[model samples]
Target: METLAFIPSPSAGEIHLGPLPLRGYALCIILGVFVAVWLGGRRWVARGGQAGTVADIAVWAVPFGLVGGRLYHVITDYQLYFGEGRNPVDAVRIWDGGLGIWGAIALGALGAWIGCRRRGIALPAYADAVAPGIVLAQALGRWGNWFNQELYGRPTDLPWALKIDPEHRPVDTPDLATYHPTFLYESLWCVGVALLVIWADRRFRLGHGRAFALYVAGYTVGRFWIEYMRVDDAHHVLGMRLNNWTAIVVFLLAVVYIVVSAKKRPGREEIVEPEAEAEPEPGTDTGGPDSADADAAPEGSSAEGSSSAKEPSEDGPGRGKPSGGKPAGDGGGDGPAGAESVAKGPEPRRKAVDGPAS
Candidate 1:
């Protein structure tokens, strides 16, 4: 008998809206992806990248990840689909809920690399920015396992035990009423890992993929222990579940990467998206025709003034003298002389108004 304190499994994992079927498993995955992109975009922008770059990259990564995850699940659990009495077409039904995180991440990285290459972006920098968000996505994705009533551990009588329907229970343990909620454990672990990554990244200034490596290391540590608890049918190696070995291997790889990357690339990337040189205004010029015209305008004005001053005046030689030899004070000859006088500091007004001493 299931206790009131135990977590209850969903009665049905799908909802039919008219003729359409909405699977909780697929909905959880989609929701997780959306949240990852939204949070990753914010982080990327904080790192000096464009706002939409994460979402744009997700367009490539999401589809590739889904395919890779499905492929991995099918390949690893081939017996579940291709076994006696099972139809081969069952492998293609992803809405039925089977996805492997290792495969998703591996192929997702490839997709992200392709996307980054196309945009001329640095993948390591982007990975660091999105590390925490990725872990958060994993946390959300674990809910899908809960909805499917899968990945739970051995029978337990704990207060927080998950109550599984008899139909969904393991054949050997059909009488079991409750089991350890490994999915919940992993989900909570992922949330903690995300917070740790964020905190560590801020505290240590982790960069150049180190932040991402830290996330992987932390996640794998939890997964290693959690994998041991899961009672799901899976291939075993050396008497250990396949995922336990994977977790151990992946954890070491992440650690080594963090160390090596720190040594090889000591500091963070200076710029996420290098600012392009600003183009000049359309109607402006940098020493072009407009500049030439500007230069010529002052020269032409000065020349016109000098020529008008020196021209044999219908007045006098000194300029505007009314046909007499005496000087004219209307300042027609003051252009060049007055400018020169002012530049030399306070002198006589006569020097500005009249011509220089012969």
Candidate 2:
């Protein structure tokens, strides 16, 4: 206990402004969300999505996520909330703190789906692009509890112990003065997971929404371990209980989905350009133009042209290797005296047979 001690509390009023109040926790959250959304929008545009789509989605997603987070928090800990003279409406006081990661993601994805549908965009692509943003937002949100001096772990004498006010510590934990900084652990862990998802997304060309699933699985791995250390009272079911089991089960499912989906994707590697594709040069050999033409052509014309163009390959008169660089009977010098092949002609073959090597 004597080895190292640095106060965990920052100046209380450092985040205040006269009568108006602004908690550092809320500031961090806003900043985190802003940054995440901006980054996600940049990524979405890079991945061939329409501009402003992410922002549009955020309009819906943020509120839904917040409400879902509040509901999850309240539902899980209703006993404390309902007991004593607690008003039912106090559950709506999300600013006071309490968010559930599971609910936030579940409802947030729904919002994204709605946004994508409105924009006429594919769902998995947007999910993949925004996965990193979600990770960063979670990392920042965890700090909100940190600023509130809550969500610490069991009391400890470890070097990095967090200084908690007496009221913040769990009742059963003997040492009220010091506890683990679970917030910092989770925050840092989230950063690592975000980077992992970014790397895997670029490196392996994870298909469909596999990258997002990886994010889920990776976050779950860390959350499972970290959840074990949370001293916050929670409802328990099964051996380890609460988030621990949820994390494990969810993580396993995510992993299974990632593995199965990745395996099913075409093995030919793909790349995400993160930018709108440029218009192609006219008459270029790329199939894009021909494909567009095929799509635009009338059905009968397209079919007839396709048949005529492809018929040469199926043993047409001129299909085989040209005899002497001309069609078999074209009005060119086919001066073939016998069966032999040469760039110039069969003349060389005839001369070779007629003369000896000199």
lDDT of 1 by residue, 1-358 (tens): 5556899988899868899988988888888998899989998888778879899888898898888989889999999899789999999999889999999999999999999888888888889888888888889888898899999998998899999998899999999889999999999999999999889888888888998999999999999998888888999999998988999999999999999988998878778766322335477676777566556643334333443444434555544543445554433344666346345532333333346869
For candidate 1, give the lDDT.
Answer: 0.82
lDDT of 1 at 241: 88
Displacement of the residue 77 alpha carbon in candidate 1, Å = 0.6
lDDT of 2: 0.72
Best by TM-score: 1
User: What is the lDDT of every predicted structure here?
Assistant: 0.82, 0.72
Q: Where in model 1 is the C-alpha error above 4 Å? A: 1-4, 16-20, 275-358
- Clashing residue pairs for model 2: 46-274, 46-275
User: In model 1, what is the error at residue 98, expressed in angstroms?
Assistant: 0.5
Query: What's each prediction's clash count?
Result: 0, 2
Best by lDDT: 1
Task: Provide the lDDT at 72 for model 2.
Answer: 82
